[model samples]
Target chain A: MKAVTAFAPATVANVSCGFDILGFAIGDMGDRVKVSLSDQPGLRVVSITGDGGRLPLEAEKNTCTVAIQAFLDRLNANQGLDISLMKGLPLGSGMGSSAASAAAALMAVNELMGTPFTKTELVPFAMEAERVACGAAHADNVAPSILGGFVLIRDYAPLDIVKLPVPEGLYTTLIHPHIELRTADSRSVLRRQISLQDAVVQSGNIAGLISALYTSDLKLLGRSLKDVIAEPYRALLIPGFYELREAIQKAGALGSGISGSGPTLFVLSESREIAAAVAKVSEEVYAKIGLGVDVSVAEVNPIGAYVIESV
Target chain B: MKAVTAFAPATVANVSCGFDILGFAIGDMGDRVKVSLSDQPGLRVVSITGDGGRLPLEAEKNTCTVAIQAFLDRLNANQGLDISLMKGLPLGSGMGSSAASAAAALMAVNELMGTPFTKTELVPFAMEAERVACGAAHADNVAPSILGGFVLIRDYAPLDIVKLPVPEGLYTTLIHPHIELRTADSRSVLRRQISLQDAVVQSGNIAGLISALYTSDLKLLGRSLKDVIAEPYRALLIPGFYELREAIQKAGALGSGISGSGPTLFVLSESREIAAAVAKVSEEVYAKIGLGVDVSVAEVNPIGAYVIESV
Candidate 1:
C-alpha cells in the first residue's frame, strides 16, 4: 500500500470520581491522519490543517509524528513517510486532542506498515506523544482512545491497566467552553497533599463508581461522582464550573465534572433527552457568563482508533 | 415466639484496597446471640460467655445490646429482651468481633420481634453498636456482617451501600495472632493527612480491585491489593505482619494485608489448596515469633447473620 488514512476518537478522562485513573472514549468527532510513502529515507510533515497553523509542522515536534517515530523505532523500520494532519479536536480543550493525533498517526503508520500491531499495542507509542502534550506519563486519555470504551490505569510503574465495562444507553454531554486552561497549569493548581478524610472519601467513590458501571446502577454512580481531591482545587480555573455542575445536576445529569483538566464540563445521563437538557443548561451557564461554548452529546465509543482505507 | 438464636459470621474489613468502605463475611466462625422474653421492661443481658470475661456485659456498654436497643428504638418496640452472648469471635482481633456480636444480637432481636427489619435495614443499628466497639461508627465490618458476601459502603451520609460480586473459587485465609491491639489504639497510629500522590495511587487500586472482582481477574485483583494509608501505620503494631504478607505472596496467594485494624493478617487465594498454603505461611510466621496463632481458610460467606431456627 502506498498510503493509509486512519481516525481516532476523543475521550473523557477523570470522569468525576477517578481523577487520574479512569476515562472512556466518546463521540465521532476526532482527528484524521493521512500517511503516504516517499522515496526519501525519513519521515516528513507535508502539511497540517484545521488547527489554524498552531501545531508544529516538524515531524519531531508534533504529537502524531512523535508517536509514529516511536512506532518506527520499536519495529526498526526505515521507510520514509509523508503525513497530513487534520485536527478535528480543539487544542488544550481537555478533549484528548493530542491523544487523538498520536493515536490516528500511529494507526495510519501501522496500517501502512502492514499492521504489525494490535490496537492496544500502540498505547505506549501514543503515550510518548501524550507526555509532550501534558508533561506527565498519564494514560487516562490515550488508553481509552486506543482501547475504546472505559479504561482504568491501575498503576503506571508496570503500565498496569484494566478495561472497565461501559453500560448501554449511557450518554456523555461535553460542553467545551471557549477558554484556555493548559493541562500543566490546571494541574499546578492542585495541592501536593490532601486530608486523610478526603482521600478515604475519594477512594470510596472510585470503588463505588466502578461497581456502578459493572452493575448498570446509574443512581449509585451519580451519587459516587464526587471528586474530593482534584475538582475542589481545579474548578477555580474554570469560570462558573461549580454553577454548571449544579445546573446539570438539576437538569437530570447522572454526574458532572471537568473533562480532563478544565474549561470543558462533562455531564453523564442515561437518555439523550436528559443529556440535551444538560447541554442546554451548560450552554446557558456559559452564555450568561459571556463565554462561547460547543455542546455535544455522545455515547460510549465501542471502538477506539481505526483505519479508513489503504491504497 | 418468645426465644430466638442467630449467628453472625466473622468479617474481614478494610480488604486491603478499600480502607473504610470494603469488607466480606467469612466462614461459620462467628458470634451467636440468643434472645428471650424477660420480666424486665427494658433490654438487659441475662448472661455472657466465651469472651474470657474481657468484654463489657452491661446492656448499655455492650456492642450487641446497643444494636438491640437501636433496633427497638427504630421500630418503637417496647418489649423487654434477655440476651445471651456466645462470643465465637475474638475481641480486638480485627476479625470484626464487635460486628458479629452486633449482627447476631440484632438478628435475634428482630426475629424475636417477628422480623420487622431487613438485613440491610439493620446496618445503622449495628453501626450504633460499632460506635461503642470502637470510637468510630464506620460500617465496613457491620455491613458485610449483615449483608454477607462482599459489601461496599458507597457513602455513609445516607448510608448508601452495594453488594459486590465475589467470583466463585475465591478463598480467604485469616490468621489471628495471639496479641491485643484495640481498634482505637491501632486507629490512633495513622496520620491525620496523606499526600495527594498516595491518595491517587490508592484510589486507582480501589477501582482496579472492584473491576477485578466483577470481571474475575485474579491477577489484577492481586496487584490491586495495596494500602498506602492505614497498613503502613498499623503494620508496626502487628509482629511479623510484613513477613507474613511477603510469605503469603510467595505461597501463591492472590493478595494479603491487614484484616481490619491490626493483630490479624488476611490473604486471598483462588483455591482451598492455595489458601491452605497461605494459612501455613501465616501460622509459621506467628509460631516463629513465639505467638499463638489461629488460622482458618474460608470461602466467601454468601450469608451474614441468619436465624438458626424457628420458635
Candidate 2:
C-alpha cells in the first residue's frame, strides 16, 4: 500500500489593501493530512481530528476529501485514497483553515501517486476545494498555504500566481478572537460598488504594499495599509476591531488589519519583540471587551505544503 | 551675476495598471529653461520659443515662471530672474510638456539661487505649477520628470514617492498623433463609480506591475499591464488605438497603453530593436488613417531635470 502524510501552513489572505489578490503563510499552525491507497475505489474520509466536530464527516462534503476526489477525476484514474485530516487551525478563524486542509490532502495524494503533477499544477484542486467552504474558488488562501511565503494572485481567471520574497526579520502576530465569523457572511458585508476616488487610493496602496515588501520599507507599508473599500463596511462585524487596531498601532506594528474574513486580526512587524508587544496590546484590548483571544508570533512560513511521511 | 540653464525630460504617466499613481521619465524631448539674474526686484519673463506663441510670456501665467515665483516666495528672497522658455515638446500631447517646463525652470532657478532644496524637495513646487495648465496639481508627470527613472506616488497627502529601478535594456516607443486631448477631458471621460470586482482586478494588476518591475520579469510585466479602469473609457478618444496596440504586441512589445491623458501612446520592449519595430508599426497604423504622428525611441531617462549651464 502506498501512503503519504503532508503538512500545509496556515495563511492570512486579503492582506490589507490587496483584498483578494495577496496572501502570506505563517508559523507551524496548519493541517496535517494522511493519504493511503484505498480499496473502496473512491475517495473516503477515514477520520478527522482536532476540529471539534465543526467539519463534515462525509467525504463528499469535506474540503480535503473533495480535493482528493477532484485530483483523481482530473487524472481520469480509478485510483482512490483514504484521507485523514488533522485540523491544527480552527474553522473560519481567518487563518486559511480550509485552505490548509485542502492543500495538505492534495500534496499527500500527489506524493502517494508518484508526484506526476507540479506543485503549481495542484493549485486548482485546492482552489476548487475552497468552493466547498467559501462558495467560491478563491486562491488567495490556498496559493500561499501550498506554495509558502508571500503569494500574489495576479489574475484569478486561469489563475496566475506570483511568488514574492518575504524580507528577512518580518514577523507576524495573529490574534484569533475566539468568535465565529463565517467567510461567506464577511464577504457579503462588502459593497459591490466603490467610488472611483476610493478605488484609485486603494490601487495606490496595493502598489505601495508590494513595493514596501520588496524594498523593506516598513513605514511605507504601515501608511499603505488603509483599506477604504472593505474595512469601512466590515469593521462593524468584527467586535472591538477598531480598538484592537488602535492598540496595535500604538505598540508600533508595521500594519494591522482584518485577516481574511475576520474576527481574527493580524499585525505585521519587523521583529519578534514588536510582534509580542502588538500581541499584548491586542490581548489587553480584547480582554477589556470581555472576549478571549489566542495570540501567536511567527515568521513567514518559508516552506509551504511538504511531505512528512512517505512509503 | 549668476545664471543657469536646465533641461527637464518629458515623462509618461499612468503606466497601464497604475492609472494616476505611476510614471517614468523618457527621451531627449523636453523643455529648456534659462534663468538669469535680472537685478530687478521681482520675476520677469524674457522670451518664449518653439511653442508657436501658445505658452504665456508673463511670469504669473507660465508654469515654469510660476514655479520660480513659488520657490522664491518660500525662500523669502527679493531676488529677481529673467526667464527664457524653450518648448522642445508640444503642449497637450500627453507627454508632460507642462511638467518638463516647470521642472526645468525650477531646476535652473534653484541652481541660480545656490540650491537651497534637494531634487526630491522640488517635486511639490513643480506639482504646484501643474495647476496652471491642468487646473489641478498632479505629480505623476512632474515627479518622474524631476526625479528621473520610474516613480510611484504611494500617497498624495503626505507625498510619499518611491523611486523604482529601471531594468537594463528596457526601451520605450512613444507615438504622438498631434491630436488634442486635454488632461481634464481625459479625466472627465471616466465614471465616478466602479464595481468592487473591477477594483479588485485593477488592484491586482498594479501589484503585479510593481513586482514585475522589481523582478525584471518582462513577460510577467507584459501580462500585468491590463488597465481595467482608465483605458477602456479613454480608448474611444484615441483613434485606431486597439489595432495599434495589437500591432505593437505582434512586434514583440512588452506592453502598450495610452500615455497620460491621451493622443499619445507608449510601448515598452526589451531592446531598441523591438522598440523601433513597434514604432514602425505605430506609424503605419496611424498613416493608413491619414494622420501624421511623431514617433520617438528612448530608454528610461536616468537623469531628470539638470543644469545645462551654470556660472
True contacts preserved, each candidate?
0.94, 0.88
Query: Best-fitting candidate, measured by lDDT?
Result: 2
**Candidate 1 deviant stretches above 4 angstroms:** none
TM-score of each model, in listed order? 0.97, 0.97
Stretches of candidate 2 off by over 4 Å are none
**Total backbone clashes of model 2?**
0
- Comparing to the true complex, what docking class would candidate 2 get? high
Show pairs that collide, candidate 2: none
B-chain TM-score for every candidate: 0.96, 0.98
* DockQ versus reference, model 2: 0.89
State the lDDT of candidate 2 residue by residue for A175-277, as single tens digits: 9887887767888889998998899899999999899889888788888988989988788988898888888888989887788889778789989999999
Q: What's the TM for model 1?
A: 0.97
